[model samples]
Target: MVIVCCSILIISCIAVVSSGMKVSLEVDRPWLRVHLSQRAALECCYRTGAASLRTTWFVHNQPANGTAVPVPVRASDQVSSGYRMRGGVTCGTLTFAEVKVADSGLYRCWFNDAGVFTPGTYLQVYEPLKKTINLSEKTKDNILMAEGFLLLLCVLVPSATLLCKSKQLHALEQKKATREEENIYQGLDLNDCDKAMSLYQDLVANEQEEIQLENP
Candidate 1:
């Protein structure tokens, strides 16, 4: 009787497994190949399965190879050894929000039955672009990075030109100011020399007048 029951159980497991699902991950295909920073969704779906079906979504593959993932009522699940919780199994679908590049992976979704429930789905996650990404945006970083390298040119180009122009203009102004100061000092010295010479000449004239008066 036990042998018969075991055989029946095995056969029933096979039958459940044979009722396989046509599964796929769903997202806008064009955005799949992009490199970006903003968030997007790596929407998991059993595209051909009916809503009446019950399933479970998992992060890392469970031991015993294909155990059903426990659906969390809250936004969290007991974090697996290497998996951080970012997605939830809703109905029969898995949804990850604020999708980053790290979110890319095979997400195994299985029907709640005993056998390794058909085939699981794989999700290729990615980050979304804030704006349209293009060659210009890619090159912009390199251009901005290279700006640091050309800093000598940036500073010297305009500064040297301005310095050259101002140097010439201020050269004449500085020279004129220096010349005026020297001229003022020289004039003062010359006036003092002239006054001394005139005083010496007056003394000689007075002495000669005395000599002439004595001789006459």
Candidate 2:
């Protein structure tokens, strides 16, 4: 009889502890994927009133091999390394302003007073893919041809201008030299004509004196 009574007491104690440890929290979104630098949220709802229980959040960063360590999330209105807590009585939200790859983890919500925790949500943060512009072969060829034409114009235009200017300068120099040569030849011809006139006048005066002497 004493053993039977002890068994009943143990059974009653087990029931009481089980009732106290009953889970009342429900977490939303079993899994989530978000790009880096985007906003992400984890929500927890409870059947019990807010007056009876307080909600808390914890995160476990996924590791490469071993088990992850859980870290408590701090509540704040400003941007923090942790998360911001929002919402009213029935539901609580943990919000990240900008999520990073390091923010990828398992998140759990707990009711400290009720001793209840919701099944965790896994968040995967990924880098966004880079954008690329696709061009057709025809378009690429057109662009290349246009660039080549512009480059050729850039080289040929200046070269043509320099060649024309050099030709003009050479023509001007030749014209000036021709004018100088013509002026020098005209001066030499004028001096030679004056000398011929003086020599002829002296030869005529000597011939007239010889004829007069022979006649006398």
Candidate 3:
């Protein structure tokens, strides 16, 4: 007799629950990260079972607890925000447009059939700070880049100039050595030695002038 009574109670409870049973509200994009001063979309989805679905927007979990209201689902393609106007969930989706820093919080999507309740999902909005510098920062970056290139060029140009001079000096040395070998039978000549010394002095003076210009 007790078992029969318990069975009846169980059947009554199941009937009450299944009568209001609805599809699960699974929010596709829950955790959304956004940068400061940039626009983002908080997307949501509700799983509509065999029966057609109804959707309402909410914030901070509970619906009635705050100012969050239901966007009437409309039948047309005209999207009021991202969801249709008539609470008519198409493919069970919704979009929170132009999301801001203050919008950084939890959002809710409730699934319903007529006026009855089902289930929902929570969306976490994250606002990450981003720095977009003004004219001053741009100017500083440019100046730094220019100075670095200028220094590199200055160093490289002088090294190249010195390398060229050394090569020329080596050539001159070879020529003088050849002449000395030839003149071994003829005797000593002071003119060639004087010309080489003059060239050396000119190179030294030019290099010193360049160094002074660069440093200043």
Candidate 4:
């Protein structure tokens, strides 16, 4: 029973080591974007030194929904419809001479002998004209927003300044008026009681003379 358990443990260790020894593939770019009719390339490399290993390239097109379906890519030595395979042995490169919008997809390099596929690179193709138009529209929007901000500053700054000046002028006018009133009060001689009585008696005498002249 002990021997059987030891054998099982040895088998488990062998399996773990085998799994760890599996070849790992690396891709140069995970995502690539190019304009229509532009050249594009994807490079894949692996550490395994054996040149006899078969490598394959596959493309998965973006779908409306659900899982993407991968299609095998086959190319010959001579450029077959602009698709060509380059590099050798430990590395492989898939290239497109002139990429079309339809060529936009996820690409993966598979090591057939190792039964492993590298993490895919997604290719995106776009129209330059459309991108330029969208950029122009965004620029126009930014310009308009900036102009509106400047206009608001132009209006608000002057209005605030004029309001402040008007308040200052009103305060100054009130102060001037108050000072004039104070000067008028200071000019009065309220302490001259005898002079005031004499003026009142003269006013009464004038009134009596006027009444006599009118009756005559």
Q: Pick the lDDT winner.
A: 2
Q: Which ten residues in a row have the lowest lDDT in candidate 2?
A: 77-86
Q: Which digits, one per residue and each the tens of the lDDT, describe model 3 over residues 85-150?
A: 235444445444444455544444444443322232334445565688556888999999999999
Best by TM-score: 4
Query: lDDT scores for all predictions?
Result: 0.49, 0.71, 0.54, 0.70
Candidate 2 structure, TM-score to reference: 0.45
Q: Candidate 4 residues 17-136, lDDT tens each?
A: 465544534434668998888888776665544444466888888788966798987675421322223364256678888788888888876555655566667899897754434457
Clashing residue pairs, candidate 2? Answer: none
Q: lDDT tens digits, residues 107-191, model 2?
A: 8766666655555678899996776988999999999999999999999999999999999999999999999999988777767
Task: Flag regions of model 4 displaced more than 4 Å.
Answer: 1-29, 35-37, 74-89, 112-116, 126-175, 190-216
- Indicate the TM-score of model 3: 0.36
TM-score-based ranking: 4, 2, 3, 1
Worst 10 residues of 3 by lDDT: 114-123
